[model samples]
Target: MNDSPGWASPGPAPSDGRPPENSGGSGPAGGAPESTPSGAKWSKEQPPAGQWSAPGTSGQRSHAQTPRPQGWNGAPQGGGWGAPGPGGWGGPPPAAKPGVIPLRPLGLGDILDGSVSTARAHWRTVLGVTVVVAVLVQIADIVLQRFVLPAPMEITADPESNPTEALRQSLESMQDSMISLVPSLLISTVGTLFTTALLTIVVSRSVLGRSVSLGDAWREAKPRLPHLLGLTLLLSVGAMAILTVAALPGLLLGSVGGALLSAFGVLAASVLVIWLWVRFSLASPALMLERQSIGQSLRRSAKLVQGSWWRVFGIQLVTALLTFLVSMIIVMLFSTIALFTDGSGMGELLTGNSPEFGWAFLVISSIGAVIAACITYPISAGVSVLLYIDQRIRREALDLDLARAAGLPGYGTEQPADHTPGS
Candidate 1:
């Protein structure tokens, strides 16, 4: 069974993973990249004020010998002359010191930066396939709308015409029709495969520098399907069970009692459901890519997310808001134009009855998908993969892998050599 569903068909993939460690090299402005080791720079042992060297001169002088790097003017290239300002009166901006890890926090900007870098590296795979997949799926939608739905409508409308009843009946028929088809089941099964593997492969290849083909993603995903399916069924049953518990009053008592309690039950169930969702959101990556079993992966996800729940939730919330607002704005703009512009009308036009339905909505959505994938897929993958990396860093001291990948300068098996930007 080919695991390559619509997502990974010989195209660009979004990048994701832990950021590689920097070699402690400085850029022109003296800023170190995120990948640099925290202990990058070297600081010297301080001497007494009386033994301080004069600015631009090497000999030990007086109690306030050097005027500091700033006031001294044109201090030489080597690392000797700088000092505390007058009477140790605070320094000259601390001589442009390098940053320390104690000062590091996982800011929104850092995750967003990781996301952006991931995309830059793997966007081609993402774009090439999303457009094609979306087009094919939507064309199937179009064909269904154009040819298939009309006959059922005609049969129900002709004055034997219980028009409203016929419409309702047709809808019921369609609903029954949808759930039982073999092809649909196959599509759904394949879709599951796509969701689990393609994204991970793209991400791993992009961030971890692994070379993965569509074939590779599929084969890797195959053995995991049973486990994934079990997880899915488990979640579905769990959700229904919770909802059923919530609806117990309605189920056994009078309608009034059930109605009164239903809302609260739903609220409680929803909270639990959301908690579970976040807890397991990264589990697919763990199971599919990391080769962990269902129970183990869930535990791993929870552990990785232990201190970062709010941050992860916030990141997802932002992604949702952006996806919703942007997709809506574009769709509505096309819809408004269709409503007002000559020949751009929809509705009856969709039944081939006033004007054009502005098919660009399809294309616009496709573009939105690509942009969304570019922005989000990588972030999602990167965060999960980076969490994996962070675990390794903590356990195996794998910051060395990150440094090597990033091509950082001056890192080794032994202690890292301290560096000063100029020195």
Candidate 2:
């Protein structure tokens, strides 16, 4: 693509998800690598595992949308390559479409569109699975909230006019909430993570055009449990560490300096954490699809993610923002009264408490969560998987495999014969 890296030939193992001979992620524009990714990859036989690149790029996002090899010319077409017109030798034919660049690299629209399309294509399955997961997760939340909490009677506080007294009351309230939430939070976190992992696998398979069942998804994720747990621990520990460090540095400062310095420190820490998050975002897919180790997955992700960090982040942001807006619209329709809080911000009442719309609040809150979950979960999962593809496209020339999978013409492989070492 553009001036990005040149594509590396695959090594010995041909991954079911990608052509193995293409360690670079992109095959030579003229020919597919002889390395099939179907078996275990010999990491040593691969490139130095340093930086990766792709080759044979062309056509900037032209003013008018280019015709997709299939119809609907306006839809984002995967980049194309063709018979080398006397310029170089032949290999994996670049995307078949004429006048297209092999390295069109993904854009924001490309990613989100893929996400929505994946969702829409499997909306029934996604919605059904999301609802099931949300119900289970929410049921767990309620059980934790109602039964497992320390009795609200554990401590008492006196309402008072004094500011210090009121502050104490607030802290006590927050503390109680947190204390009661501990067990449930832990459970919910685990449940949510598995849900995230499963959803991620589904989205990945959906994008990859493989048939997947809920059972299949769970089976896929089962082996990766420890790595996923390790990732969670890393993030939680890192966050706490940063907050602790930030707080320590500011304890000596007065409120004003402390606030300023702590905010700066926290902000810096956040940026670093965000970068790490993005780098590891593709780890799960790498782990499952490629059967990589935790360390190997992390490094593979980092290698692919080197130059396109901002683009990946932008894709996530746009998806989250879009889903948030949808959630807000639901809130406005069903929880208008809850949004009707008093000037003090504590005077609002739900219809469950009021004769008017009490049921509306309960319904809105429950239904809203499900609706939001359905929309948000799939999109988030889709975007993450799409990010994996986007990285490969930029670094390894994944677009070629994608074109083949989509069955667009000109890729032209006929089962085993076409399966020759790099095809």
Candidate 3:
């Protein structure tokens, strides 16, 4: 709220029965156009006074938080509009208290708080789902690392070894290591799909302040499992295809020129994928919450994400970084413990001096991964789901439906009578 781009604390509504204004003119404070992404918005014809500015004034004050109306004594009233004032304006009549988010358009803080509040409110169900998935993933990864992965082939000193043969041997070793990782990758991917689907459902219910048990969430999610899997596969395949295309420059041009071009192509490809990933990131939530097919979900994400690329990207990037930091901390803690207890030669194992990891190192690291996943999954999934909701509230006026669903009164109509095209 303190001059941050998108947040404004609610202030008291103006007393003159006029929409709040920026120094320049009417409209949300910022000088952004009407279709500006998310910073400010125009109210319908009957937009509550002080709540919305007229369309088109390049509202410089757009970043200012519209204050909820106040009571006679000047205390902030209940509900977004607060108690109706002298001219039938003032508060939006009384409504049920919002559970996780207010029944109004949200700011960045609201979105972030909503995610944490959802987890706190439904800790048992959310944590329970994450724990189960993380445990399964950890178990699979441990088994793959301990038993399924092949031991590296030892190479004796070849007094007359050919340079080409040595190169071939190195490539083969790399291929073997990659092969050993496939099972772990597959397990992690499957777990991610399952957790994302289930947590999305839980998060949606939390938005409506509805009670959902693990059984209810599971039942709701079960029907969409196949489609969710298909969706994940579709996205995975698309990403790989994009990466492969990017790598082509490097591949087709074998010389130094080709290598340089390939490197450039890869950098460009990485940027593209990150952009595409942010744009399509909402697909999982769309699919699970809307019961859409894989293709429909992708289209839905693209549509909702249109014109809001940077905002979505920023939120996602922050969430990802936060989760990664937490995961790293956990892994480091376990690694340190293992080091003191039994991590004698992990460096050698990593460098291929040893054929496989010792059990203590493997178990400790695996446990760290599981714990990190358990903590981070809910936060990540919660933020994604909330972002989806925020978009809907902004573009589709979903707040009304959500309010009604939460049993709030005085929001029965999508738009107030005065909120007409010609008004």
Global lDDT of each candidate = 0.47, 0.57, 0.67
Error of 1 at 128 (Å): 3.1
Residue 286, candidate 3: C-alpha displacement in angstroms: 1.1
140-225 in candidate 2: lDDT tens per residue?
Answer: 76565556664653344566546555555655677677777777667667765776677666666565455567777777677777
Worst lDDT window (10 residues) for model 3? 1-10
lDDT of 3 by residue, 179-218 (tens): 7777878899999988887888777788777778898888
* Best of the two (1, 2) by lDDT: 2
Cα TM-score per model: 0.53, 0.65, 0.72
Q: Between 1 and 3, whose TM-score is larger?
A: 3
Candidate 2 local Cα displacement, residue 402, angstroms: 3.5
- Model 2, residue 25: C-alpha shift (Å): 15
lDDT of candidate 1 at residue 102, scale 0 to 100: 9
Candidate topping TM-score? 3
TM-score of 2: 0.65
